[model samples]
Target: MNHNEYMMKKLYEEIIERVGVGIHAVNQEGKTIIYNKKMREMEAMDKEDVLHKDVRDVFRFQENQSSTLLKSLQNGEEIVNVKQTYFNNRGVEITTVNNTFPLTMDGEISAAVEIATDVTRMERLMRQNLRQTKTDFTFNHIIGKSSEIKEVIALAKRATRTNSNVLIIGETGTGKELFAQSIHAESDRSDSPFITQNCAALPDTLIEGILFGTTKGAFTGAIDSPGLFEQAQGGTILLDELNSLNISLQAKLLRVLQERKVRRIGGSKEIPIDVRVIATVNEDPIDAISNNRLRKDLYYRLAVVTLFIPPLRERYEDIPVLIKEFIQKYNELFKLNVKSVSNVVLQFFEAQSWPGNVRELEHVIEASMNLVNYEQVIEFDHLPYQYRKSEVKMAASSPEFTESMEETMGLTDQLALFEKQTIEHYLHKHHSHITNTAIALGISRQSLQYRMKRLDIRVQKI
Candidate 1:
């Protein structure tokens, strides 16, 4: 070859080897011809082991029938963005998004070239992102003027003065993390890292390593890595759905809380850490303890300061305010000028049960805004399909049989009656399971029991 052709070929090979993606090519006979540096790194294979080898012999496909390179070569076709996951000869699993096309010469297929992007690190990053939270919430951002919520806010503010571990109990989507973040923002540790992990987001085996650092040779593919505790040094780490952790891990967590130190998964030495932990539970703490999902001793340690966020249903007066705030938020987010909701839509929203709590309310408003035109009020027609159909489920006015009874009762008594009826409906619907009923009512089991007693209601066994 001439010097210019040789230089050009050398440059092309160097560029392909150093590229970010894994590049592999096979001859028409399915022999491994060109495997670049990135490909070797992605598969954890040595160049000497893969070069000039049979492609099928070196890369062990989970299913031979679904191999992209083989299929592209056999059919003389191109495949784009096919997700392939398989183990190499060393049993190391590799996952990649692959694009394979048949190389041609003189209108005849000569080989197949495959370009793959390793998604292992990307998947880990996505999981970490799911567990991470960023909040700009403080006491003033809590968005409620009701007396009940104001009382809760007062208690939360009191918690900011101390550095004790806090346990926040609330139903799903009741903004437990918001309260956690607000406390962190107001506390002495506000300047430090505010890391978060959802305890239920991972399996038990993985969750342990993620919370406590993993040591080298701890297990297969395990490296010496700092866990969330180390990452949140001198700061606060929020463990959402803390009750989802099993009892054994809970014991380890208890030790961490008691000693203020954490030992890596396979290490003998303990590392001292100064981190305030804030844990959240969607179920009633009492029920969680009874169900063995939470260790009583650990609960005592974590609940040194407890905060209970009341649900949207209990603080129904906050609905209108929350709706207005959501409207303003979507106006800025979607860049539309939605003014207000129709009176009929507002009445329906206030009367309907929000099973998903505040998050659900936000979704409803955002969806309605998407359907409404700019500078127009959101009418019932603009509501989501399910919400529009919910109007048919609303009950008609009271019958004449209760008219005389309603006259004698004061407003407080009438409100109490309404509350009792709502609780009863949820209790019966959930077959009287305290946990389920309390969750449906968006209150803790203890609070639900108190309401039941105050209203003179009895739960019959199903």
Candidate 2:
């Protein structure tokens, strides 16, 4: 070869090395002929290790799975964007998306060339997300066995069988997202992405761009990237707090649902989507429409299959079970061995209204557990001040009991008793932080310490 041919050949080699993609080729014998630099890095092998080596001997392929490259060469066909997982020379797992083509010379197959993009990270992330979706939002998360919740969960399970849109209606903290996630995990698209976007979290000005995506220069700081809809292709996209979106944005979302396509903000091209939409409303859909917070058109579109999650107050029978679940959770979390709540405390938990739903009940248990140390039973007195203040008063009848009758001790003793309870509760609330607790009690650090000693309240762990 002349100098010009050698130079041209050298230039081609350099271009292939820096192309940022993995390229590999093999002869009809299935021996590696060309392995680019990117391919070596992706496979964690050197050129010397791969070149002239049989793919079957170098890579670990399962006995059942077909090799896309060999398949293409055998059929003289092209396989596009196919994923392959195999162990490399160093026994490291590798994943790649490949476009394999059969090279032809004189109307006969000569070799096979494979263009690959390493997707090991993407694959792992997708699997991690799938695990999280299943783990964090399974039927087990319901943590209740009441008929109201059971009925709703049954409906949700049926909703998962179709690709139709779902609208979950419930009050706040009633586990709307939990049902959405459970449905996604049980659906046909379980292997794909499960993205959640709260309509309230999106800015009004950029809601369009964020939901539909934006092209570079569409607006200041706009990026040429896939939006939530595109990113959740072949999976589920959960629109949380659906009523928080304005009517105009709701209209755009309805259009996307109706057309099954999305156009980026300020862009003319439309991209088709195959995503299962699950929207949540933290209020009655009828109330939202009447209040002008939600559009009726959007509601009708999203509520193809509507589900209502009953609040924890309505599931009174589930309180004891919920309390047990929370205790077990805190046992694992706080590294304690708390076993149960006292019978009276259980009665109190069941009687009161949990306006915040199951979440409020959980919080009460968590806070009460923090006050315990190696204790097996949680009592009413062990609960947070808000809960026990009433319970203690009702039980004790009054703060008149003292070590002695002690004439003229009535009002002063009563005031001291109130002060003692207030200081102790504030200390625990602030996690034994002297400065913060003092601030909360509107007293100085020295005064708090003096009061603690005078009231015989022991100092807890800092």
Candidate 3:
């Protein structure tokens, strides 16, 4: 080799060695002829291992990039900003954002040079930022992903954005609170106060004072405290079981709804408010008006954007997911190692009509987690008895309810009974279509089969 040739080769090697980007030169046959130090580090490979190796043998592209990457390599076209992350043996994932530009010699593609820039930290930060920016109300926390639930969420989100009044109607235990909270969370008011008041929990006078502020001298010992509507200023006020509010109070609420202002007790001046209103009623507002529990005018104002949350029995498909969340919740709270439910027990839960809905199921799982002594998997015996009280012969079931064995029986028996009753109820609800039945039951087809064996429940094949 001449002196100039030697110096030229040394300069080329220096450039490849010092560059931070992973640079690789592959021959026309797709064999690695030159692999830089950075390239070997990115691949977690030794210099000897990658040198003279087939490019296809060691370098793996993403599943969807086969055609574009291979064709570009053959045709000498440049592909840029191809994003990918590769995991190494040490469990470290390296993200590469790069361009693959082919080298042509004498007007024909001969070799290709890939310039890969390490972007692991950047990619991780981007993902973290995306997660942080995610709306506080998530599809996951909302429970059901059914089409009905999806439509409701989308409409609720739109309503929240516009500051419209929302009236949520659902049977008791149908997760009215969840929907109310989600709407508030997804709205611009998420960072503001989310005040909740159950109208039925107070007497008419007390309820009026709670919803609207009272003057210090209005009544004996009145301290001029602001009520829920004032407290929720610049945010949202959730009126739970709004139908329970009496006729007179409804008139006051309707005035506020129309005027967007409130007058303190014994005070002539009206104080303006920017509070958004969200009310939930277990009964239909129309029925409430007919029965004189709710005023027709107030109902129309509150129902500007109405949402109905279906009963637990109606959306039985969500039972299993809710149960699992409750199980994980209790496991964390009680510091238990319980992992899952047995097929029979799961089937029992899936099939039952959860009249009490998510709240009822959560209570049952929490009780069962505290009851089970040895098994990691919750069996039929781990459930409560209200579930199966009708089925158990009274005398024979007494020994199972002994107080000495309360830890052994009370919680578990209740859960089991609840699970059994729920399964039987849903089976009847679905008219016993095993597929729809299994879906409502929230278990695998196989698990349902085993449960049928244990419960001695029969259903004619659809």
Candidate 4:
């Protein structure tokens, strides 16, 4: 090869390796021939494991479709922005969008190349939002040590003793549903079904039909259906955000609660339901009534057995326990060794009134942990962009971070530090098995060996 051509080839290869997207290419026979670093990271596979292997064998799906690369190679079709799911050899589910193009040589298709963008985390999060609660998750999932929370739990535990309806009032994200599930799990109806419906999630027309069964001719394209109440007949139904219901629906719900009977939308028969009721409201009951968001009479009936959950601000003592729990949780989840939060972060967290309560704090920590690669402590820089405002405000008051920590190394030195720590962590995890560590780190074994040598990580001797 000439000097110019060789230089150009090297530059192109470097660009492919450094690109921020996954790239994989397959030969005409559908064997993976080229897999870049990003591709290895995305699929959690080494090039050695993928190269020369048939694409069909590396990934599978129940839809019985060929891999995108194979499809492109066989049909000479250019597939763009197609979102699909694949089960890798390890049975890990992956979701991604891909652009695939068939490469031709001498007017014949010779290979196919795919550019992939991983969306597995996003799609799973969306699914978790939409999926129904199973209720096997019991009181153990509730994390708190404060007497306020303990008293609430005690009251909820008492509520489970009887079949009386329950009203849980709390700020949003204060673990109302956890209490509901805990009650259901401990109730006499534990063997029966437990169902939940968000009353505020639907409109008047749809929610009425959903909560109260609909006849075939009840509305346009309506079919005979049993409502959520009937579905929970032998168990419990949790109506979330009860105050968000329209006044008319509130009256209807009140009637159902009072009468213990439900009449279908268009039917004359009143069906007797033997379901236990548990409902939640995300506001103070008195204000909800004054604002016309809730009916006083209905509130009186639902609050027959009331349990109030204190918000995070009201229970500041639980912050340290929660932080430790979350750190341990995410350490197991993300496969890392995050030991704790820095003192400043902990102080800032305790000082702030978490408007979103425990859920918000958990998310902040989760996002911060995602940024923590090799750090033992989650520093202020690891806080998400949304929380940076709070840091700026805090700096004005105390100037903690600016004075306490200063950059001690250049970019190259810092990069080396991170690499050394990361390699050492993975080495410990994999018992210094070079191939396993390399696969876990998304690098070829030889590359990992070279990096270890340069970083002075001596555990490869094991």
Which one wins on lDDT? 1
Q: How many steric overlaps are in each model, in order?
A: 0, 0, 20, 0
TM-score, one value per model: 0.64, 0.57, 0.56, 0.59
Q: Which is the leading candidate under TM-score?
A: 1
Worst lDDT run of 10 residues, candidate 4, spans: 397-406
What is the lDDT, from 0 to 100, of the residue 246 in candidate 3?
85
Which ranges of candidate 4 are over 4 A from the true structure?
Answer: 1-133, 397-462
Model 3 weakest lDDT span, ten residues long? 126-135
Q: Per-residue lDDT for 1-462 in model 3, tens only? A: 999999999999999988878887778777777788887777777777767777556555555654233456787689766666655444466776567888888988888887876656434533443333223444357777455566777777687677889999987877787788888887888877777778887678666766787775565324355766777788888888989888888899999999999988767779899998999999877788899998888888988899987666555556667777777788778888788887666655655656676777778888778778767888766777765563344324544445565555554455455556656777888888667877876654555665676567777454
Number of clashing residue pairs, candidate 1: 0
Residue-level lDDT for 424 in candidate 1: 80
Score candidate 4 by lDDT: 0.81
lDDT of 4 by residue, 1-462 (tens): 999999999999999998988899999899988899988888888888899999887788757655877889999999877766888789888877788999999999999999987767545533443344358667788888878888988888888889988999998989898899999998889877788877777678767867877765554334466777777778888899998899998899889988999988878899999988889999999999999999999988888899999888767778889999999999999998999987657756754658899999999989999999899999877989878785455444432234323255432343345557767889999998989987887654655765676567798465
State residue 371's C-alpha deviation in candidate 4, in Å. Answer: 0.2
Computed on alpha carbons, the lDDT of every model, listed in order, comes to 0.82, 0.80, 0.72, 0.81
What is the Cα-based lDDT of residue 292 in candidate 1?
95
Model 2: which residue pairs collide? none
Off by over 4 Å in 3: 1-139, 391-462
Ranked candidates (TM-score, high to low): 1, 4, 2, 3
